[model samples]
Every structure is written in structure tokens, then in C-alpha cells.
Target: MDRSSPAGNPLPAADRADGGREECASEVKAKLVGAKRWRRLRRLLAGVVVLGLTGWFALPWVMPWPAALSRPVPAGMRITDVHGTSLRRLLAGGMRAETPPKLPEIPKALVLATLAAEDHRFYRHGGIDPVAVARAARDGVSAGRRVSGASTITQQLVKLTVPRARTLRTKGLEMLTARRVEMIWSKDQILEQYLQRLDYGNLHLGPAAAAAGYFGKPLADCSLAECAFLAGLPQSPSRLNPWRHADRAVKRQQWVLNRLGVLGWADADSLARARAEPLKLRRHYGFFMAPHFVDLLLSSLPETSRAGGENLTTTLDLDIQRTAERAVASHLARLAGKNVTQAAVVVLENSTGNVLALIGSRDYGAADGGQVNGAVARRSPGSALKP
Candidate 1:
């Protein structure tokens, strides 16, 4: 029952059907393998997405809070005169700025200026500003590099507390920590903390110190111009230092004032006046009188009290100390030709045994054993002490 084709031998329909069946089986197997591979790829992608979501939700809780926030602020003890005038500032560590003021004590103008200069949307944002971020991203893309920043005040505080190199990983951690900080602290508390730890030029740590050191006044007494001047310093303290680079500082201040005017925080008259007002920047190295006496008093105290937060008021009077210093200097000048290289003056009150003045040497700043406590040193009493 075989039939012959035109150019072939006899062919059977059953063989042709068997060959067709084999081809069909091959196509089905290939399709099944492709489907299995697609399923495996989808599973892998789903696992990655799940892991990413889990990490995003759990990062803040897993990351530890910054230790610097919990640690006590490093403060120094103060030594004052009987009239409560500061005679010397003694710090166990590096030099610190003046004590920071509370939120209420901070000046309104300064706050406004700071908000305008640093973060205009500080109150509205949680820890990041989406609008600013988008703008910065777009700008960066156009510039082919990072041209601007979008860090909120909260994010800046986090960065200050936990410093790290500039990288995507560090920035991600900073943003996460900033969110956590905002959740833990209120708006006022976060702002106050930021002001307390903010670095303002010349070792000044806070606005209080900046006011005192730069303006020779309290934070509450700072004028609008002064406030603007100080507000501009936190951007680049060293570069905009009022003492060192007044021109740059004034430019920055003008910028802040302009921002304030634009924000309607200050009227035109006030902004104009601030721009015209001259800042009387004071260069204060802090009161450093009665060095020898202060040394003795500190030596007598326990290490804890010397470096503690408490201020010590001594029985010494500042006026009498000045008088005694002048008298010693004049007398030493008179005896300059008599080989008298040193002199010690000690003034005591008759009513009380308190020391009115104690000068250890003619010049405490001299390099030749000037720090020797001559008043307390054992020496033969000359004719001046004759009975």
C-alpha cells in the first residue's frame, strides 16, 4: 500500500505522521524550558525587591542613635572677682564658646535671619525637603556635578553630630538619622540643640558666644544688623569671619538681610537700616587677670570642681588687683637700675583676712621664672617687715 512520489521512492503516511509528532514534542520541550527560566528570573527579582523594602523600613530602628547627642557638653569653670566680674576662664579641655542661651533667650531677629539664611522651609519639612531636593537634583544634572545642597536643618544637625566622609552611603545614613532625630526631638528642641552646637568662627561654638566674642554683648541685646552678621557666619565661619574678613562677612550679611526682606520677616525700613548699620566687632581673648592667684586657687580645689560647670567667685577685688599691678610696675621701674628684677605685692583687708590683691611677680607674662609664686615662696623678710 506504498505510494511513490515524483523524485523519491515509496513513502508512507504513518512515517510522516510519526515525524510530525517528534517535531511537535521538540517544540513543546523548548517552550517548557523557556517558561521555567522566566519563572526563575521573576522569583529572583521579587526576592531582591522584598529585601530592599525590608531594609528601607527597618534602617532607622537598626541604626544606633548618635552618642554625641547624649554626652554632656564640654564646659569650663569660671573664676570671677568679688564683684562677679570674670577674671579668668579656665577650661580643662580646648577653648569653648560662651554658654548657649535657651530658645526664649535667643533674639527674634537672629532666629529669623538664621532661618532665612540656612533653611527657609525648616518648619515645614520633617527632615528633608522634596522640592529643594528635586531642584538640586535637576540643577546637578544640568551642571554635570553637584552644584547645590538640599540638606534640611535637621539633616545638618545629624551631620554635625555624626561626621562622615561625603559619599552616597554616608548621605543615606545621614538622611535616615535626621528623620529619627526629628521624631525624637520637637521642633524647638532640635533648633535649640543645633544652635548650641553650631560652630561660629574663632572657636565660638554657639550664637551666645558669637555675640559675646564678636559684639561684646549678650545674645538678647544684639541689634538686627549684628544678628544678621552672626547669622551669616555659620555658612562659612572661617571665610566670613567678621574680624578677619569683614568685607566677606558684610556681603553674607547683606544676603541674609535680603532674604529676610524677601520673606517679609523684616520690613523695608529695617532691612535698609541693617544694611547701613556698622558692626562693631570686638576681638575678645577673654579676661586673663590674676593668673598666679587663679593658679593657686585652682591647685587647692579638687580636679572635678576645677573642670566642672560651676563658676567660682573669689574674695579678690578686681579694682584692687589693678591698683596693685600698677603700683608694682611703677615701683619696679624705679628700681630698674638697682638689679631688682622681681617684686611681689600682697594687699590684705584689716576687717577680714581676705586677700585684696596678690601679685606674684612684676610681670607674670615674662619668660624668666615669672610664674613663680613669690608671695608664697619662703624668703628672708627684709627691713620692710621690721617690727
Candidate 2:
């Protein structure tokens, strides 16, 4: 059957209705397909987010926490004489170091300067600074080489505790370890450990030592300029040595001060004062006494006990030791004409045979064989043995 309108002829009404329904059904099918695709995409994205969050949360548990942090003596060990005078300080692994300052004793200005210079976002970041990492990446891409680093204080601490060659693998491990460290340690604790073990130039191991070595003063007496000066050394200790490379160190120091001012850690007036202040570097030697005897005593103890911060008192008397050293020096001077290069002396208590003093050599600082303990060394038994 055909239908006719007022102006034109048309197909049957049933056929028209059937065509309209078919078009509507096709549109509905298309919409359904698009919705399914959208849902699938959303699910995929959700899965990726879930996996990322899981990994982020679980990494600290899976990675190994550094054992060095739990140990008490990351700073090093100290050896004192009978009268409580510091004789020598042995570093964490028996190397020589200056006595470290307590964390609370370090000045606030130095802490601020360090934060400004090394990691401004130290408090905000967990273990890594995403902003710094992004900036480093962008700069590296622009320069076609690595011009800077993104390591946080936490990461630096991890690297210090577990030293490794600079490689991608090492960096990844450091990142993981740093994350673990942050979980176990507070910000102040991390900072204390880092500062205590920090190696300043010329064997100055900590803030107190650096202050004394560079300015011939204690950490408490260091001025703001001196604090800023020391806060800038750890970047490259050898290159920024104020003693050897004053210009470089000063430049780095100015940079640190500028950062402090810009970051609001220091006021403009202070920064100005620091910039104008002259840095006077002086060489300060560590307290070194009875070197050979200390060495022998430390060697005899178990390695673990050396760093326990225990004061070891011996029967050796300071007066007797000084007398014995003078005697050895006098005897050596007399034998200087006989080609004799070294001398040792040992003073024993009359009744108990306890060694009151032992002079290993004429001079421990001597270059050639001056550390040889002649008293303990095997020598030809001359008539001297016939007491």
C-alpha cells in the first residue's frame, strides 16, 4: 500500500516506521560499543594506579635497612689518657679523625646553611625530591650531560653508610635504602648522623673539628660566616679546601649564603655580614700522644669494643711518659753522630713491674722507622740484658 501527503507521494507508513526504528537501533549499538571501550580504558588505568601505589608502599619493607645506622659509633672512636686528655681518635674503621661534636652543640646557623646548600626541601621530602629530580632531568636533557645531582640529605646519608661506585644500580639501591631510612629515623636523627660523619677538608671529620681546624676555634665560637663557610665544604672537600683553595671555598660559601638569604633561612643583613667577613684558616693538629702504645692497645681489643666510647685508663703516668720521651730524645741526639736513627725507652714500677711509661721511638712523627717499638722488637742481647 502507498500513502500520499497533501503535496507529495510517499512510501507506505509501515515501511517508514520500520526505517526509523532501524536507524535508532544502529545508533544505540554504536553508543553501547563506545561505552564498553571507555570502561575498559578506565579499568586499565585503575590497575596501573593500584600497582604503582602497591610498589610505593611495599618498597621499604622489601629493601634492606642499613645496619650501620643502628650501631652507636658511626662518628668514630676516641682514646683518652689517664688524666682524661684525648690522646687519639679513631674513625669508624680505625682511621684517624678529629673529635666530633654533639648534635645539640652544633649551631643553628650551620644547620640552616647546610639545609639551604644541600637540600632546601629536606623536611618536606620523604627520601627523594621529585622537584629536584625533574629539574635535574630537564637540565641534563638540555645540556646533553649530567650537570647536577638530585640526591637528598637522606640519600647522601645512605650513600655515606653504604659506599658504592656511582652507577645506576647503586643509585637505585640508594634511593630504596633512603626510603627505608626515613621510615626508621626522624629528620633530626638523620641530620645528626650525616653531620657527625661528614668529612670536611684536610681530615676534619665533623663540625667541631672543621671549626677548630679552619678557624682555631670551637664550634660554639664560630661566627655566622664561619658556619656558612664550613657548611659548603662537603660538596667537594678536596677542591673546596679553604686552606688550599680559599677562592673556590669562598665562592661556594657565597653561593650558600645567597641560598640561605633567598630561602629566608637567613636575613639579608646577616648574609651581607657573612659575605664581608674574612675567613681565616689555621692548621690545628689533633691531640696525639703515646701513638705506638695506643695502637697496640686498640689492636689487642676486639674491633667491636674500640668504638664503644669507653674511656680506657692504663697504669702509664703522663709525667713518667714525658720524662721517658725526653730521655729517648736526648739519647737519640747523642747517638746522632753514630748513625743511630731511633731510640725507645720503658720505665717500669719497681715492685709490681708495671710499665709506667713506654717511649716507642724518638719521634712518632718521624718519617723513617720512627714508629718501630724498639722495646718489643727483637735485638741482639748485648751486655745490657745481664742486669
TM-score of each: 0.78, 0.76
lDDT of 1: 0.84
Q: For model 1, state the Cα shift of residue 138 in Å.
A: 1.6
Q: Write the per-residue lDDT of candidate 2 for residues 81-178, one digit (tens) a residue.
A: 66766666665553334555667889999999999989999999988789999999999999999999999999999898888999999998898888
Q: What TM-score, to 2 decimals, does candidate 1 have? A: 0.78
lDDT for each candidate structure = 0.84, 0.82
Clash count per candidate: 0, 0
TM-score of predicted model 2? Answer: 0.76
What number of backbone clashes does candidate 1 have, counting pairs of residues 3 or more apart or in separate chains?
0
Alpha-carbon shift of residue 172 in model 1 (angstroms): 1.3
Model 2 ranges with Cα > 4 A deviation: 1-23, 75-77, 81-83, 91-94, 98-102, 289-306, 314-387
Each prediction's RMSD to truth = 8.0, 5.1
For residues 273-324, write the lDDT of model 1, one tens digit per residue.
Answer: 8899987888876678998888888889888676644678999999999999
Model 1 segments more than 4 A misplaced: 1-59, 301-304, 333-341, 349-353, 366-372, 377-387
Alpha carbon deviation, residue 108, candidate 2 (Å):
1.3
